[model samples]
Target: MTIREITDLVQGEVLCGEERAGDEVACVFASDLMSDVLTLKDVDNLMLLTGLCNLQSVRTCEMSDINYMLVVRGKEVTEDMLELAEDNDMVIVRTKYSMFKTSGILYAAGLPPVY
Candidate 1:
Protein backbone atom coordinates (compact mmCIF):
# COMPACT_ATOMS: atom_id res chain seq x y z
CA MET A 1 0.00 0.00 0.00
CA THR A 2 0.96 3.64 -0.36
CA ILE A 3 2.35 5.48 2.62
CA ARG A 4 -0.62 7.85 2.56
CA GLU A 5 -3.03 4.92 2.79
CA ILE A 6 -0.98 3.33 5.53
CA THR A 7 -1.11 6.56 7.54
CA ASP A 8 -4.87 6.72 7.16
CA LEU A 9 -5.24 3.07 8.16
CA VAL A 10 -3.26 3.36 11.37
CA GLN A 11 -4.22 6.96 12.16
CA GLY A 12 -0.59 7.90 11.94
CA GLU A 13 1.03 11.24 11.16
CA VAL A 14 3.93 11.68 8.83
CA LEU A 15 6.62 13.26 10.93
CA CYS A 16 8.84 13.66 7.88
CA GLY A 17 9.22 12.63 4.25
CA GLU A 18 5.75 13.90 3.50
CA GLU A 19 6.82 14.28 -0.11
CA ARG A 20 7.24 10.55 -0.37
CA ALA A 21 3.82 9.68 0.99
CA GLY A 22 3.00 8.30 -2.43
CA ASP A 23 5.67 5.61 -2.00
CA GLU A 24 4.37 2.07 -1.96
CA VAL A 25 5.39 -0.74 0.37
CA ALA A 26 4.59 -4.38 -0.17
CA CYS A 27 5.65 -5.78 3.20
CA VAL A 28 6.50 -4.96 6.79
CA PHE A 29 8.63 -6.22 9.66
CA ALA A 30 7.49 -5.18 13.15
CA SER A 31 9.83 -5.29 16.11
CA ASP A 32 11.27 -3.35 19.02
CA LEU A 33 14.61 -5.13 18.68
CA MET A 34 17.13 -3.58 16.35
CA SER A 35 18.91 -6.93 16.27
CA ASP A 36 15.86 -8.49 14.65
CA VAL A 37 15.99 -5.82 11.97
CA LEU A 38 19.69 -6.39 11.49
CA THR A 39 18.88 -9.98 10.54
CA LEU A 40 16.96 -9.11 7.40
CA LYS A 41 18.47 -9.75 3.96
CA ASP A 42 16.20 -8.33 1.26
CA VAL A 43 15.07 -4.96 2.59
CA ASP A 44 13.49 -3.55 -0.54
CA ASN A 45 10.02 -2.06 -0.37
CA LEU A 46 9.77 -3.01 3.31
CA MET A 47 8.39 -0.79 6.05
CA LEU A 48 9.29 -1.16 9.73
CA LEU A 49 6.66 -1.04 12.47
CA THR A 50 8.29 -0.58 15.82
CA GLY A 51 7.63 0.67 19.33
CA LEU A 52 11.27 1.63 19.67
CA CYS A 53 11.37 5.35 18.91
CA ASN A 54 15.02 6.17 19.39
CA LEU A 55 17.89 7.13 17.15
CA GLN A 56 18.96 3.51 17.22
CA SER A 57 15.77 2.58 15.38
CA VAL A 58 16.50 4.96 12.51
CA ARG A 59 20.12 3.93 12.53
CA THR A 60 19.12 0.32 12.28
CA CYS A 61 16.86 1.12 9.37
CA GLU A 62 19.68 2.96 7.66
CA MET A 63 21.96 -0.01 8.20
CA SER A 64 19.41 -2.49 6.91
CA ASP A 65 18.40 -0.29 3.95
CA ILE A 66 14.79 -0.26 5.17
CA ASN A 67 13.56 3.16 4.17
CA TYR A 68 10.15 3.51 5.76
CA MET A 69 9.46 3.45 9.50
CA LEU A 70 6.19 3.54 11.42
CA VAL A 71 6.73 4.40 15.05
CA VAL A 72 3.94 2.88 17.09
CA ARG A 73 2.62 3.37 20.65
CA GLY A 74 2.68 7.15 20.33
CA LYS A 75 6.34 7.15 21.29
CA GLU A 76 8.02 10.46 20.66
CA VAL A 77 10.56 10.86 17.86
CA THR A 78 13.53 12.92 18.89
CA GLU A 79 15.14 15.61 16.78
CA ASP A 80 18.23 13.49 16.41
CA MET A 81 16.18 10.63 15.01
CA LEU A 82 14.33 12.92 12.65
CA GLU A 83 17.55 14.52 11.51
CA LEU A 84 19.14 11.18 10.87
CA ALA A 85 16.08 9.94 9.04
CA GLU A 86 15.96 13.05 6.91
CA ASP A 87 19.61 12.69 6.10
CA ASN A 88 19.02 9.16 4.90
CA ASP A 89 15.89 10.05 2.89
CA MET A 90 13.72 7.93 5.14
CA VAL A 91 10.06 8.26 5.93
CA ILE A 92 9.02 8.53 9.59
CA VAL A 93 5.44 7.96 10.61
CA ARG A 94 4.04 8.01 14.14
CA THR A 95 0.87 6.44 15.56
CA LYS A 96 -0.79 6.25 18.96
CA TYR A 97 -1.90 2.67 18.36
CA SER A 98 -0.09 -0.25 19.93
CA MET A 99 2.28 -2.32 17.83
CA PHE A 100 -0.22 -5.16 17.59
CA LYS A 101 -3.04 -3.00 16.31
CA THR A 102 -0.84 -1.17 13.83
CA SER A 103 0.55 -4.38 12.48
CA GLY A 104 -2.90 -5.88 12.08
CA ILE A 105 -4.18 -2.78 10.35
CA LEU A 106 -1.34 -2.69 7.86
CA TYR A 107 -1.40 -6.42 7.28
CA ALA A 108 -5.13 -6.34 6.61
CA ALA A 109 -4.59 -3.42 4.30
CA GLY A 110 -2.48 -5.78 2.12
CA LEU A 111 1.01 -5.02 3.31
CA PRO A 112 2.31 -8.55 3.80
CA PRO A 113 4.46 -9.83 6.64
CA VAL A 114 8.19 -9.94 5.95
CA TYR A 115 8.48 -13.29 7.60
Candidate 2:
Protein backbone atom coordinates (compact mmCIF):
# COMPACT_ATOMS: atom_id res chain seq x y z
CA MET A 1 0.00 0.00 0.00
CA THR A 2 1.00 3.57 -0.56
CA ILE A 3 1.53 5.86 2.40
CA ARG A 4 -1.39 7.99 1.23
CA GLU A 5 -3.67 4.95 1.19
CA ILE A 6 -2.47 3.80 4.57
CA THR A 7 -3.06 7.26 5.98
CA ASP A 8 -6.62 7.22 4.68
CA LEU A 9 -7.28 3.71 5.98
CA VAL A 10 -6.09 4.60 9.47
CA GLN A 11 -7.54 8.12 9.48
CA GLY A 12 -4.10 9.55 10.05
CA GLU A 13 -2.47 12.96 10.03
CA VAL A 14 0.84 13.19 8.21
CA LEU A 15 3.39 14.94 10.41
CA CYS A 16 5.96 15.12 7.64
CA GLY A 17 7.16 13.73 4.30
CA GLU A 18 3.96 14.43 2.45
CA GLU A 19 6.13 14.39 -0.64
CA ARG A 20 6.55 10.66 -0.17
CA ALA A 21 2.89 9.91 0.29
CA GLY A 22 2.87 7.77 -2.84
CA ASP A 23 5.62 5.55 -1.55
CA GLU A 24 4.88 1.84 -1.50
CA VAL A 25 4.82 -0.17 1.73
CA ALA A 26 4.83 -3.92 1.23
CA CYS A 27 4.80 -5.08 4.86
CA VAL A 28 4.52 -3.89 8.44
CA PHE A 29 6.42 -4.32 11.69
CA ALA A 30 4.46 -3.16 14.71
CA SER A 31 6.31 -2.90 18.02
CA ASP A 32 7.10 -0.59 20.89
CA LEU A 33 10.37 -2.44 21.53
CA MET A 34 13.36 -0.90 19.83
CA SER A 35 15.30 -4.12 20.39
CA ASP A 36 12.71 -6.07 18.46
CA VAL A 37 12.80 -3.41 15.78
CA LEU A 38 16.54 -3.94 15.36
CA THR A 39 15.88 -7.62 14.65
CA LEU A 40 14.22 -6.73 11.38
CA LYS A 41 16.45 -7.44 8.39
CA ASP A 42 14.03 -6.61 5.59
CA VAL A 43 13.55 -2.90 6.14
CA ASP A 44 12.86 -1.85 2.57
CA ASN A 45 9.28 -0.79 1.97
CA LEU A 46 8.34 -1.78 5.50
CA MET A 47 6.21 0.43 7.70
CA LEU A 48 6.87 0.64 11.44
CA LEU A 49 3.64 0.84 13.39
CA THR A 50 4.08 1.72 17.03
CA GLY A 51 2.94 4.06 19.78
CA LEU A 52 6.45 5.30 20.48
CA CYS A 53 6.41 8.85 19.22
CA ASN A 54 9.86 9.68 20.46
CA LEU A 55 13.44 10.12 19.38
CA GLN A 56 14.29 6.51 20.18
CA SER A 57 11.81 5.19 17.63
CA VAL A 58 12.96 7.72 15.04
CA ARG A 59 16.58 6.79 15.58
CA THR A 60 15.75 3.11 15.39
CA CYS A 61 14.12 3.58 12.02
CA GLU A 62 17.06 5.59 10.76
CA MET A 63 19.52 2.89 11.74
CA SER A 64 17.28 0.15 10.38
CA ASP A 65 16.65 1.98 7.06
CA ILE A 66 12.91 1.86 7.68
CA ASN A 67 11.40 5.00 6.15
CA TYR A 68 7.78 4.82 7.19
CA MET A 69 6.10 5.12 10.60
CA LEU A 70 2.50 5.08 11.82
CA VAL A 71 2.04 6.23 15.37
CA VAL A 72 -1.04 4.93 17.18
CA ARG A 73 -3.25 6.34 19.96
CA GLY A 74 -2.74 9.86 18.70
CA LYS A 75 0.47 10.35 20.66
CA GLU A 76 2.02 13.76 20.25
CA VAL A 77 5.19 13.63 18.14
CA THR A 78 8.11 15.61 19.43
CA GLU A 79 9.56 18.32 17.20
CA ASP A 80 12.96 16.71 17.49
CA MET A 81 11.61 13.49 16.09
CA LEU A 82 9.79 15.32 13.32
CA GLU A 83 12.90 17.27 12.32
CA LEU A 84 14.99 14.12 12.26
CA ALA A 85 12.44 12.23 10.19
CA GLU A 86 12.01 15.08 7.75
CA ASP A 87 15.75 15.41 7.36
CA ASN A 88 16.01 11.70 6.64
CA ASP A 89 12.96 11.79 4.34
CA MET A 90 10.97 9.42 6.50
CA VAL A 91 7.19 9.57 6.47
CA ILE A 92 5.36 9.74 9.81
CA VAL A 93 1.61 9.44 10.26
CA ARG A 94 -0.39 9.78 13.47
CA THR A 95 -3.74 8.17 14.14
CA LYS A 96 -6.30 8.24 16.95
CA TYR A 97 -6.78 4.48 16.66
CA SER A 98 -5.05 2.06 18.99
CA MET A 99 -2.19 -0.02 17.70
CA PHE A 100 -4.37 -3.11 17.47
CA LYS A 101 -7.02 -1.47 15.35
CA THR A 102 -4.49 0.23 13.13
CA SER A 103 -2.67 -3.05 12.62
CA GLY A 104 -5.88 -4.83 11.75
CA ILE A 105 -6.85 -2.20 9.25
CA LEU A 106 -3.49 -2.37 7.50
CA TYR A 107 -3.45 -6.17 7.52
CA ALA A 108 -6.94 -6.35 6.12
CA ALA A 109 -5.86 -3.94 3.44
CA GLY A 110 -3.33 -6.61 2.33
CA LEU A 111 -0.23 -5.37 4.10
CA PRO A 112 1.40 -8.49 5.52
CA PRO A 113 3.33 -8.95 8.74
CA VAL A 114 7.09 -8.73 8.54
CA TYR A 115 7.73 -12.18 9.92
Candidate 3:
Protein backbone atom coordinates (compact mmCIF):
# COMPACT_ATOMS: atom_id res chain seq x y z
CA MET A 1 0.00 0.00 0.00
CA THR A 2 1.10 3.56 -0.61
CA ILE A 3 1.12 6.26 2.00
CA ARG A 4 -1.61 8.06 0.09
CA GLU A 5 -3.70 4.91 0.17
CA ILE A 6 -3.24 4.65 3.94
CA THR A 7 -4.23 8.26 4.38
CA ASP A 8 -7.36 7.67 2.37
CA LEU A 9 -8.20 4.50 4.25
CA VAL A 10 -7.58 5.80 7.76
CA GLN A 11 -8.16 9.53 7.39
CA GLY A 12 -4.87 10.17 9.15
CA GLU A 13 -3.32 13.59 9.38
CA VAL A 14 -0.03 13.94 7.52
CA LEU A 15 2.38 15.61 9.92
CA CYS A 16 5.07 15.95 7.25
CA GLY A 17 6.42 14.65 3.94
CA GLU A 18 3.13 15.37 2.21
CA GLU A 19 4.93 15.28 -1.11
CA ARG A 20 5.96 11.70 -0.51
CA ALA A 21 2.55 10.24 0.45
CA GLY A 22 2.34 8.57 -2.91
CA ASP A 23 5.41 6.54 -2.00
CA GLU A 24 4.78 2.83 -1.84
CA VAL A 25 4.93 0.92 1.46
CA ALA A 26 5.54 -2.80 1.01
CA CYS A 27 5.16 -3.73 4.70
CA VAL A 28 3.99 -2.53 8.08
CA PHE A 29 5.51 -2.95 11.53
CA ALA A 30 3.62 -2.23 14.72
CA SER A 31 5.67 -1.73 17.86
CA ASP A 32 6.57 0.82 20.52
CA LEU A 33 10.01 -0.57 21.30
CA MET A 34 12.75 1.34 19.51
CA SER A 35 15.11 -1.59 19.95
CA ASP A 36 12.74 -3.89 18.07
CA VAL A 37 12.68 -1.53 15.11
CA LEU A 38 16.43 -1.09 15.21
CA THR A 39 16.98 -4.82 15.19
CA LEU A 40 14.92 -5.20 12.01
CA LYS A 41 16.97 -5.56 8.82
CA ASP A 42 16.68 -5.85 5.01
CA VAL A 43 13.30 -4.16 5.03
CA ASP A 44 12.14 -1.53 2.58
CA ASN A 45 9.21 0.79 2.26
CA LEU A 46 8.09 0.08 5.83
CA MET A 47 5.26 1.90 7.54
CA LEU A 48 5.90 1.90 11.28
CA LEU A 49 2.91 2.08 13.60
CA THR A 50 3.47 3.02 17.20
CA GLY A 51 2.16 5.00 20.15
CA LEU A 52 5.56 5.77 21.62
CA CYS A 53 5.39 9.52 21.46
CA ASN A 54 9.06 10.38 21.77
CA LEU A 55 12.07 11.55 19.78
CA GLN A 56 13.70 8.15 20.15
CA SER A 57 10.96 6.66 18.02
CA VAL A 58 11.91 9.07 15.24
CA ARG A 59 15.56 8.19 15.67
CA THR A 60 14.72 4.52 15.48
CA CYS A 61 12.82 5.12 12.27
CA GLU A 62 15.80 6.94 10.81
CA MET A 63 18.30 4.23 11.71
CA SER A 64 15.95 1.52 10.49
CA ASP A 65 15.37 3.27 7.12
CA ILE A 66 11.65 3.46 7.83
CA ASN A 67 10.09 6.13 5.64
CA TYR A 68 6.71 6.26 7.27
CA MET A 69 5.34 6.26 10.83
CA LEU A 70 1.71 6.14 11.93
CA VAL A 71 1.17 7.09 15.52
CA VAL A 72 -2.00 5.65 17.07
CA ARG A 73 -4.08 6.34 20.23
CA GLY A 74 -4.22 10.01 19.32
CA LYS A 75 -0.89 10.64 20.97
CA GLU A 76 0.77 13.91 20.05
CA VAL A 77 4.23 13.82 18.45
CA THR A 78 6.54 16.48 19.78
CA GLU A 79 8.15 19.18 17.61
CA ASP A 80 11.55 17.63 18.13
CA MET A 81 10.26 14.36 16.74
CA LEU A 82 8.81 16.10 13.71
CA GLU A 83 12.00 18.00 13.08
CA LEU A 84 14.05 14.86 13.28
CA ALA A 85 11.65 13.05 10.95
CA GLU A 86 11.78 15.93 8.53
CA ASP A 87 15.54 15.77 8.52
CA ASN A 88 15.32 12.12 7.65
CA ASP A 89 12.53 12.65 5.08
CA MET A 90 10.16 10.41 6.99
CA VAL A 91 6.42 10.69 6.82
CA ILE A 92 4.62 10.99 10.18
CA VAL A 93 0.92 10.65 10.82
CA ARG A 94 -1.37 10.72 13.86
CA THR A 95 -4.60 8.77 14.30
CA LYS A 96 -7.29 8.65 16.95
CA TYR A 97 -7.66 4.85 16.79
CA SER A 98 -6.04 2.41 19.17
CA MET A 99 -2.92 0.53 18.04
CA PHE A 100 -4.72 -2.81 17.74
CA LYS A 101 -7.67 -1.34 15.90
CA THR A 102 -5.48 0.63 13.58
CA SER A 103 -3.33 -2.37 12.80
CA GLY A 104 -6.40 -4.49 12.16
CA ILE A 105 -7.85 -1.98 9.78
CA LEU A 106 -4.63 -1.75 7.83
CA TYR A 107 -4.08 -5.47 7.85
CA ALA A 108 -7.61 -6.19 6.67
CA ALA A 109 -6.98 -3.69 3.93
CA GLY A 110 -4.13 -5.91 2.73
CA LEU A 111 -1.05 -4.23 4.12
CA PRO A 112 1.68 -6.86 4.25
CA PRO A 113 3.52 -7.80 7.45
CA VAL A 114 7.17 -6.95 8.00
CA TYR A 115 8.01 -10.29 9.54
- List TM-score per model, in order: 0.98, 0.98, 0.96
By how many angstroms RMSD does model 2 differ from the true structure? 0.6
Q: Candidate 2 residues 1-115, lDDT tens each?
A: 7999999999998899999999999999999999999999888899999998889999999999999999999999999999999989999999999999999999988999988
Ranking by TM-score: 2, 1, 3
Off by over 4 Å in 2: none
lDDT for model 2 comes to: 0.94
List the global CA lDDT of all models.
Answer: 0.93, 0.94, 0.88
Give candidate 1 misplaced runs (Cα > 4 Å).
Answer: none
lDDT of 1: 0.93
The residue-by-residue lDDT of candidate 1 on 29-97, one tens digit each, is 999999999999988989999999888999999999999999998998999999999999999999999
Better of 1 and 3 by lDDT: 1
Write candidate 3's Cα lDDT for 1-115 as tens digits.
Answer: 7888887777788999999988998989999988888888866888899999899899888888888999998788888999999999999988888899889899999998978
CA-only RMSD, every prediction = 0.6, 0.6, 0.9
Candidate 3 residues lying further than 4 Å off, grouped into runs, are none
